[model samples]
Each structure stands twice: as structure tokens, then as C-alpha cells.
Target: MSLRLHTLVHACAVVLAAGCLGATLWNGIAERGIALAFGVLVAVGELTRHNGPRVRQTAPLAAAGALAYALLGEAGGRPTHHDAAQIVTVVLAGSLLGSVPHVGRGPGPARDHLARRTLTVGFVAVCFQPLYARGTFDDWGGSAHALLLLALLSLSTLCDAVLAAALAHSRTGWPFPPVLRDELRALPGIGAAVVATGAVMALGVAVVGLWALPLLSVPLLLAQLSYRRYAAVRATYRQTITSLARATEIAGCTPAGHARRVAELSQSVGRDLGLTEPELTVLEYAALMHDIGQLSLVDPVPVGATAALPVPEQRRIALLGGAVVRQTGVDPRVAGIVERQADPHREQPLAARIVRVVNAYDEKSRTGGPGGPLTALEELRLGAGEYAPQVVESLARVLSRETRERDGLTRPGAG
Candidate 1:
């Protein structure tokens, strides 16, 4: 079957399943209608969701908000099973239909999507199961009830981080520690959103009872739109920096695409080393602009050359480049990485070490200072005291993976 037709069929199946589940859980037509309305909102949010940072996924935030509302209502002595079932149905159906646009993209992405949503709803179920048995939120005082809800939300977030990290590690073969670290770094932001939504639901229930639940969607949808706009702005900013980096090559100060190549390599190595998404982002920007100081020198270093420079000259380049970056009000972390690119490993951040190693490899490979990539890697390995061993190994692995992928693509009839 064609991909579009297949996607339609899948979406229809999901819709039917959701309808059946909702009907079974809630006998009232009005209750079923409300559940389906939330489902549609979640599906729309998923469809409109933008790609988030590497360590964080934002598409599920709206569904999470919806779930929080449902849970809060359940905590108020409403039917627990009905609430749980409604949430699962909405999340599952919304996720399936939201993914219709991406059908045929690949099995890997599809699996990741399924893994994320399944773990998400599963965690919700686990959190609510105890409340279902207890059957009353009024047994606890208001303060205790609020604290309990917060605890449940926090536990859910932790489970999400662990599961997401595991999935990422499996896919990329990255070490679990670093992957886990990345996810932990992203939790505060996502956790805040989920908690804020729960707070709103609490307020609604306090004021107007269960009927006020659906009204919570107004603010949640607005939050989603705001997040989308913020993501778009960040993307545009990245592209602008990239374009400026390329201008240096156009001016004959660097090899064509050198900045982009180093940035890409640095990101891969940084990820493997367990840098957070924000840190990786700064590393990439620093890598791209690492040679910006060369523009100020009358005798610029030759294209595809940095290792050949004297120590003092190299430090001068780093200081100057850092100053230029700082003037733009970019993150202080990015400025710090650029400034310490020439520093010893023990004195520098992991990001700095990554940029330094990848930058050296690019220069050596392009200028033929060494025999090739392998020789350059060996040279870096010999200087272990000055570089982190793990970072060097990560660079090697990245290069090897790239080579393998290139070979696979170029083989006859590969496509």
C-alpha cells in the first residue's frame, strides 16, 4: 500500500480503538465527548510540535498537561479507572495519529516515538494506581494532597528521563552515564512545565469543580504555541551563526566548510562524552567560530592549518576569538570554551577538550601535516597528557562511523 493510504488506515484504526475504549470507560455521552475533545487537542499538539533539543523531547508536553488534569480530577474522588483509561486512550490514539505525517520516515524514528509515549503513559498509570485503591483525596489535607501530586509528577519525570536515556543509548551506542546525564539536565525545564499545568488544574478544581477541567486546555495550548515560537527563534539564530562562520571561508581565511565540519565532529564527540544539550550547542558554536580571530591578523594562518602555529600565537587567536564571541552576548559558557580551546585538558571543560581534538584532526587531515585521519588520531593519542583519552577515543569512533556510512552510501546499487 502507498504510504499515505497506509497512514490513513492506521489513523482510522487508532480513532476506532480510542472511541471503543472511551465508550467502555464512561457511559455518559458527555463524558465520552469530553475525553475525545482532549484527544483531539493532544493530537493537534503532536502534529504541530517542533523538533526539540537533542536531550529533550517536547511533543508530549501537551499530552502530559492533559494527563495531569485527568489525574487531578481523579484525586478529587472521581472514578479512578475511568480517568486512567481515558488518559491512556487519548495519549495512545493522539500519538498514533500525530505520527501519520511521518510514516515511512524509518523504523528507527517510529520505534523511538512508540517507546517514548508508551513509557510516558505507563508511568502515569503506575503513579495513579495507588490513588485508585485509596478512593479519596479528601482523606488527606489540602497541603498533603498537593504535596502528593507533586511527588507523583516528580517520579513520573524521573521515570521518563531514565527510559529516554536508555533508548538513546541503545540507538547511538553512547555510554549510559552521559546519556542519562543529558536527560537529567533537561528534566528541570520539562518538569516545570508539567508541574505548572498540574497547579492550574488544582486551582480549577478548587474553584469550580470537575467542569473546570477542560478549560485548563486554554493555557496549556498557549504554552505549547509559545514553546514552538521559542524553538523557531533558536533555530534561526543557529542558522545565522552558521552563515557567518561560512563567510570566513569565503574570505580565504579558512578552508571551505572547515567550520561546519569541525562543529559537526565536535557535536558527535561531545554527545558520546555525555555533554548536555545546552553544552553541546555551545560547543558547536565555539567550534564554528574557533578561528574568528584569524580574521584580524595581517598574516592569517594558512587555510586548514592551526597546529603549525606557535603556542603564543595560538593563545592569541583563542583570546581574540573569545572576545569577539563575548561581544555578541552569547552564553558565557560558549565564550569560555572558545577562550580555553588552547588550554591544557586539566584546566578546560570537556567541551573545550572536544573542540580542541576535533579541530586538530580537521587541520591535520586537510593540510596533510600527517598521513591521514588515522595518523592524526595516533598523534592525538600520543599526547594523552594534554588531551582527555575518552575524548580522543570518541573522535576516533565518530570518524570511523562517518567512514562506514560514506562507504555504505557509495557502494554500487546501495540505494
Candidate 2:
């Protein structure tokens, strides 16, 4: 199903792009100067785009330029004549041309990104160009024009977000609602800037002509640069946390890669349980350092199997981990989760409950084991009275899917 859906997404984009290119060839070109200007703006945007892991919108400037072109009605008080097909063609050309240099140097836009970009621009152009060409928006002058552009861009932005989430879900088999929730959560940030800049560029072009393109683009460029810096800072912070999490292993208090395995499994379960993005982050950080407290232990629990230790010892280690987390200036919630992972399920927050269950599962399956994964899971289930029943179930489901995926019993992108 995901395979077909994934193909359908790309197929739709290919069809739209083909139609636009064919139409443009038949219709020749209109307002070549304007098209070239916006095309260059888009290409420049792509060249300067941020490629950070956490970046939601990588090419904000390209998006704004294309959207502005879609909503364009007049330039320098003269009615511009470019249509939907021309708008899509120009943007597509710009995207391809801009990606050329990045071919061997770095990662270019993926198939999904291009598909999303093409479809989004096509959507905006289809809605606006025909309406303006028909003179339906003739009376929409001044504030009416600005408001209409804003409304159109807002709707287009929402559609792009939905498409992005849908494509991601199809390609990765992640649950849709959580992915959609994250996209919607980003709407107020770079999404807003994209919409506002697109609309403002359209308005600016109408009054001040094509010269408005470069001048109106300054704010978004600055915002993009600032966001890149922020992404760098965030990446550095996460690296620092990861290095810290490895301390137990470095000191031989825990098995090599134990923290990483637990963190990965915990995050997978957290997503399966429908934790939001920020909640998942806290869960991951807490899971990675869940064993940091073992560094404080006088003697490491054999194989770092804190899960087999007495409750008091586990609690002591958890408290010590929390203290260490606090001293590192991490998020307070992360510290809290680390601190409370040893508490009873009902008394603990969901993140803490997740860490506790997944940690035990990893320890059991890896070392304190006989039947391996199945045996470890059985043990965790029997002790669900201590672990949250819901979290344990989520862990089981995540592990089951992972097992099938690993064994190739399930198809790629099958959840």
C-alpha cells in the first residue's frame, strides 16, 4: 500500500510537471523578463538553502518566490500575462538548475522534496492564475488584493504541509497524525514567514514592479540565516548530549552501545505511543543517559544490568543520573524524566515510564536472557504490573514491527 501510495505521489507530481511543460511549449512564453527574474530568485534560494537535520523547510526563499509568482496579477501597474503552466515551468526549471552544483558536493532535494515543491506551486498557480486571467479578481484592488493573496497563500501553505506529511508517512511508514501534528506545529514558524513573504512579494511586485523581488526578499534571507545558526547550535547540543550519554560505556560501567540501543528503542516506542516531537526529544535524552548514574555506582551492576538489581539500587542510580543531568544544564523536563524513571508507572510521567520499560527490555534481551527477544518481552509483560501496561504494549508492538522488518517478513515501508 505504501509502495503504491508513494508511487502515486511522485506520479501526480510528474504528471503535473509534464502537463505544465507541454502547455508552456504550446503556448510559447509570456513575460519572459518576469519569469527569468523569479526563476533566478528561486535558484538563488535553493543554492543558499539550509540542509540541517531538524530543518522543516529547507528552501524557504524558493517557496516564497514560486508562490509570489503564482499569486502575481500585475507588475508596475500593468497586468502581467503569465499563466499557471508558465509559473510551474519556471519554478521547476529554477529548482533543477539550482540543484546542479550541489549534485556531487552535498545532498540535493530528494524525490519527495521536488514532488512536494512542484505540486505546491502547481496548486497555487491553478487556483490563482485562471481566476486572475478571467478577470474574476479585477475588482480585488489594494487591500482586497493583499488580503486575497494572503488567504490563498495560507491555504496553499496548509496543503503543502499536509502533502509533506502524507508523503513522509507513505515513504517511511510513520503514523500520519504524529507526523501531521509536527508539520502543523511548524506552521507558526518558518511556514508563517514563507506565507507572509510570498504574499508581500506579490503585493510588492504589483505596486513597485519586479524590483520588489530582491528588496522584499531580504527579511526572509536574514531569517533563513538565523535559523541555520539555530539549527547548528541545536545540533551541537544534541552531539554534546550523545557524547555525555557514552560516558558510562567509556568508563566501562555499561556495555558498549547499550545507551544508544536503549535510546533508539525508547524513541521508537515513544513514537508508536504517539508522543509529540518535544516529548520524544525528552524521552530520547533521558533514555540515552538513563545509565549515566551507573558511573556513580561503586561497582557497576554486572553487564550494566541495572534492571536485575534491587529496586533501591535502581532508584539510587536513577536519582544520581538526574543529578548529573541537572548539572549539565539540559532541559529540566529531561532531568525530571531521568530522575523519575525508577518510580511506579502511575506516579511517573509517560516519558519516564517509557525509559524505564525500554531500558529493562534492552538489558534483559541483551544479557540477562535465554530466549532472547521473545523471552525478554515475556519477562517485561509479566512485570507489567510495575511498568506501565500501555508503555509495555507499545514497546512490544514496536519490537514486533522491527523484528519483522529485520527478518524481511514485512515489506519495506510497512508498519
Candidate 3:
């Protein structure tokens, strides 16, 4: 069904529950409102977090809000087998809707995490009615029901955590299930299904008290499940991207050590420029991956050719590099910057300029003997247009200080 149709059905269910349940609806509405409000708050917080730990702190709040709402209501509703059945329907409907957006998507670490989280949340929302049903009974069955509910909830959450971890792995590239992906894409409908199921549970409880709670829990749980899962998946995807970047640093003859000098120089420049942590992460990844396209260079040119390709050959090389980056399917502009690492003066942004300058320093430094390093004037002249003048000057000052401290600038043309 269309989103509008699902929404309308959900609205009708809420209205019916309110009319049928009276006082129960009054209490549950306020409680559900609080839960939803908390969900919104946590989502906003997760969006702004600077790190994983901060983002993770929001999930517990969502769980706490759910528990609080469930705990506020009293016991003694009717037998809610119908409520239990309705919850399963709502969960299945919601899962179908939530997975819709992901349909036909292929294997990817990011997509896998997203699918896993959605499935876990779907399971949790669907099992809500059973949990509440267990809550309503006063006997030993009630205890067993609560235990089962707890186990299901734990399993759902565990699945999400596992997916998050898996998505962060460098080697992972699991295909997302087409059916499940489509369900995730249609989450608004899935959310509506939860609401509808909640209304039914609320209605059952109004007629019978605590008995309807199992039904009520379904909607409450469904509303926030997707949001949390999305957050976790996003974190996982970032880690995977970082791993890919680091892999690029290690792809060539020098191993990942080739990027070490670039990173060090860039960090020095970053401190000089007062970059933030997020900016530094971006710089580090870009620097590490700057030479990635070189790995795809076929019939490998001699080492110095990076600086002296004929015009036609240069264009051909750049095109080859661009193609290799496109194969990874990351952002093209980012790929373009990496491809142009050997040509820093191509009107890049400041960070790209810094990266290119440091890259040049590392390439040149590798050629220099370990003994006394090149003279300041010699190094500056060698590195002039290829690196920023200020960066060259900074290296000059550092070298000058080191030479003075270690050897009293005794060498000819040194101080």
C-alpha cells in the first residue's frame, strides 16, 4: 500500500484505540509522546556527536525511554492473543516498508550494516506485543513471557551490534537482501504499522488493563528502532572507508610507510593551520590515499616520470587514474584530487594544497641521504614551486635548527 494509505490506517487505529480504551489511551498517549520526543532528541544528538562514544550514549536513552513508558502503566488487561497476532502483522508490514529503499542494492559494507540494523529493529518491534502480553499476565506465565520478551529484545539489539562491527571490517562486502532493503526504504509505512499495532494493544488494554500492553509495546518500539540502527550503520561505514584509505597507503612498493612522511608533514602543517579533529581525519585519509591511483598505473613508468610525462601521455595517465578511482565508486571530486597529487597547483582547496606540498617533501626526502640532509637553500630551490613557499621555509627552519644543535652548522653554506 502507499504511504498515505498506511498513514491513514494508522491514524484510524489510534483513534479507534482512544475511543475504545478511554483512560488507558489517555495515559499511553502521553507516555508514547514522551517516548517519541526522546527518540527525536536522541536522533538529533546522534547527528551532532563528534565521535562514536558520544553517538552510542544516545541508544541507552532510547531504551530507557521505552522501559519508562512500559513501566508507567498498571496490570490486569484481557487475554491479548489477538493483540499478539496483530503485533506480528504490524512488524511484518513495518519491515517490508523499511526494507524498500535498499532493494536491488549490491554488496557493500555500509549497506550490509544498514540491512542488519533494520532487520534487528524489525524483529524487536514485531516481538513487542508478545513482551506486553507477557507483562499483562499475573501468573508464572507472565514471568515466562517477560523472559521471552527480554531474550528477543536482547537478540535484536545483539544483531544490530554485530552488524555494526561487521560493517567496520576492511574485508567485508556482503550483499544486502533485496526484499529487506526495500522494506528499509519504506520506513514511514513501517512506522505507521507499529503505530497501528500500538493502537490495537492500547484498545485491548482499555478493555482489559495490563493485558493490552504487549500490543502497545510494538508501536513504541518500532518508532525508534530504525533511527538507532541507522546511526550505528553510519558509524560502521565511516570505519570501513577509513580502512579502504589506509589500504591504499600500503598498496605500492614502499608499503604503507610511504604515507607516513606525508601524514607527519601534514599533521605539522595542520597544527600550523589550526585544523580541527574532523578536518585532520579528512586530511589524513586524503593524504594516505593520495597516491592510490599510482597502483593502477600499467606498464609502470620509470620513477621520475611523475614529474615529466609528455602532454598526451599525461592526459592518458590521468584518465587511467580516474578510471581506477571510479571503480571504487567513491566521490569523483575526491578521486580527482587524489589523481592530481603530482600536480598540486591545479587550483585545489587549502587542505589539498597542504597535502600535495607534504607529498612532495616525502618524495624528495626519500631521495636524500640520512646524514646531514640537504642545505636549506638547496632544499628550498629544489622544492620551490612544487610546495608552498611557507612550507619550504618551515622545513628550512627545522633543518637549520637541527644542524646547529647537532653539528654547530659547521658545514660549508650551512648557517
Candidate 4:
């Protein structure tokens, strides 16, 4: 399922639990009803086809269910201390489950980082809640006590999610699944949630008594500042990458242009693989500069010799390409791609994979010396599994169209 849907479902669960807990306390509904409902929901989710990782990934939402059960038990006339302890236990359990790791295309590193934050916050809640209450809630009304606890837990969760997401973004350059980045980029919503929850709770406790606000606010503010600084750095890096990519296009403007065709064709393949705009920019620069290392390739044969140089020349080209990218301050992830292209046997990075595919086609098309387009196709087929499959397919399509156009066998737009 989409990450948006997943997060929305969790948010809904929190709200619904709050409403049910409120109703049970005020109207004296059997607290068992809320407990049963939550139990059924958890059981259904567990028995569903989802794997362990997804269930664990979403365990934070289960805390809402836990809160509801505790509130209901107290409202149904159970002892206050008993239900509060249950609430603390269940919330901690839920937080622990969230800390369990999951595997997927969604950024696992970022998720693990967030999970650690949640666990830390959960621990704080378990340790501090009892001290904060100091047995004062034993005789308090069930409704008021439940509201206070719910507000505190929600605020704590918000703090963890906000801080974790910001730190993860700085480290991973985006949140897991991309949608999370968009959500995190809208961090004012998190701030509003904290402020609103605190404001509502302040009606009972003095605004000054909400010590969690000021304590958590400092970290949240720092996270926001860090996120902004990272964004600024990324923006400047993006401009440099774009300028370099455009510079490659200007290097040679003949009919068989250098970087533009490679970039356009590389982008077409990258699009097929669901890469983002920023990823495309990185791919373009990497592709355009793939041959920068070739500038260092020296002819093994003397000027009088007509024989082509050996594989060592290709190795030299790849090494030079890596040097150029490193000099430009490209991220290690991108630089690794340029460097690995030297050894075709090595796993090529996605960016380099695309560049290599198009570069081969362009070389064959321009040289047109021996096997022509067929020679290029054969070379790609030989390295099929070594290259990204989608990139190879894009090269084939581009070549077929170019050939058909040349032979008057197809129109410009014909595929």
C-alpha cells in the first residue's frame, strides 16, 4: 500500500481511539467494548497477508489501541492505578515493536533511525509518567486522567516522529518512500500538533506545568534548523550538478551531440525506473561525464599503427571518470558509480549503468566502423545482466528509431 494511506490509517486510529476513550469515560460505556474493539483490530491486522516486517513497521499505531484499552478499563470502574500501569505497559510494548527493523525499497536506514528515536521517547514516557503523576491520578475522574495521558502520549509520539524524520532526512537525503519526505517537509503541522495538544492539556494543568513542551520544543526546533540547512546545501549542489551537465552539452554541438543525447536517452530510461527529479539530475551529470575519464585514455599503438588499443585503455577511462567526479565534490554514492564503470564485471551503479548503455550505443552509431548498430546490440547483449535491464531496453529503442529514421522507414515520432 502507499505510505500515505499507511500513515493516514495510523492517524485515524489515534483519533478514533481518543474519541472512544472519551465516550467510555463520560457516558459509562463498558470499558470492555473499547478493549475488545482494539483487540479485534490488532488480531485482524496480524492475521492479514502482510509480512512480519510491515506489521512491525506499523507497531507505533498500535499504541493508540493500547491507550484506548487502558482508558476504557478505568472508565468501566477498574482501579485507576491498575489501568494507568496497563497503559504504560502497552504503550511501551507498542514502541518496542516499532523499533523492530523492516526490509524494503523504502529507506530501511531511515526507518531504523526513526525507530530508535521512538524507542527512546517511549522509554522516557515509561520512566517519567509515574514520577509526574506521583499517585495523584488514583482518585482523579477517569475522563480527566485519560485525557491528560492521551495528550501526553500523542505529544511524545509527535516529538519522536518529527525529530526522527528530520535526522533521517539529513542522513539519507530524504525520508523512506519519498512521501514521508513530503510529509516531513510540512513539519509545521507537527509543530501545530504539539502546540494544540499542549494548549488543550493546559486547561487542566497550569500552562507552566506542561514541562514536556519546553523540554521537547528545543529538540524539535533544532531538528527544523538542521533540515533547513541541509536543504540549502542540497540546492547549491543541485545547481552545480546542473551547470556541469549543461556544460557537457556545449562541449560539442554537432549532429551527434555529446551530452544532450546521452542525457535525454538516459533520462528516458531513468524515468522507466521511477527515479525522482533530483535522481535524474544526478544521473544526467554522471552520464554526461562518463567519458571525462576517456580524456586520459592513451593510444597503445603508435600513430602509424592502425590497431585498436586493448582493454587497459577502457580501464584507464573509467579511472579518469571517477577522478573527475571526485574533484567535483559529488556524493560518494554518485562517485562510486563513475569509478565502478572501469570494471564492467563489477556491479555498475544505476546512474553509471544508464550512462554506459547509452555511451556504447553512441560510440557504435558514430563510429559505424565494423558491425554498426548490430555490433552495439551484440555488445550490450553480451553484458545484459551486467547492466540495468531497463537502461539496455531504452538504448535498443533509441537505436531502432534512429535507424528507421535514417532509412526513411519510420517517422520522427514512430517508436
Rank candidates by TM-score, best first. Answer: 2, 1, 4, 3
Candidate 3, superposed: residue stretches over 4 Å from native: 1-239, 242-254, 260-264, 274-281, 301-319, 344-346, 371-382, 391-415
Root mean square deviation (Cα) for candidate 3: 18.8
- Count residue pairs with overlapping backbones in model 1: 0
Task: Give candidates' CA RMSD values in order.
Answer: 6.2, 2.4, 18.8, 14.9
Put down candidate 1 lDDT per residue, 208-317, tens digits, no spaces.
65565557656666766776777788889999888867867988989888999999989889877777677778889989888887777788787748666877888888
Decoy 4 TM-score against native: 0.38
> Model 2, range 253-297, lDDT digits (tens) per residue?
988998899999898888887777888888888998888988888
TM for candidate 1 is 0.77
Q: What's each prediction's TM-score?
A: 0.77, 0.94, 0.36, 0.38
lDDT of 4: 0.48
Instruction: Look at candidate 1 and tell me the lDDT of residue 310.
Output: 72
Candidate 2 regions exceeding 4 Å error are 1-3, 368-371, 403-415
lDDT (C-alpha, whole model) for all candidates: 0.69, 0.89, 0.45, 0.48
Candidate 1 wrongly placed segments (more than 4 Å) = 1-31, 69-87, 101-110, 126-143, 198-214, 343-349, 368-371, 383-390, 401-415
**Which of the predicted structures, 3 or 4, would earn the higher lDDT when compared with the native?**
4
The model with the greatest TM-score is 2
For candidate 3, the per-residue lDDT at 250 reads 52
Best by lDDT: 2
Minimum summed lDDT over a 10-residue window in model 3 is located at 170-179
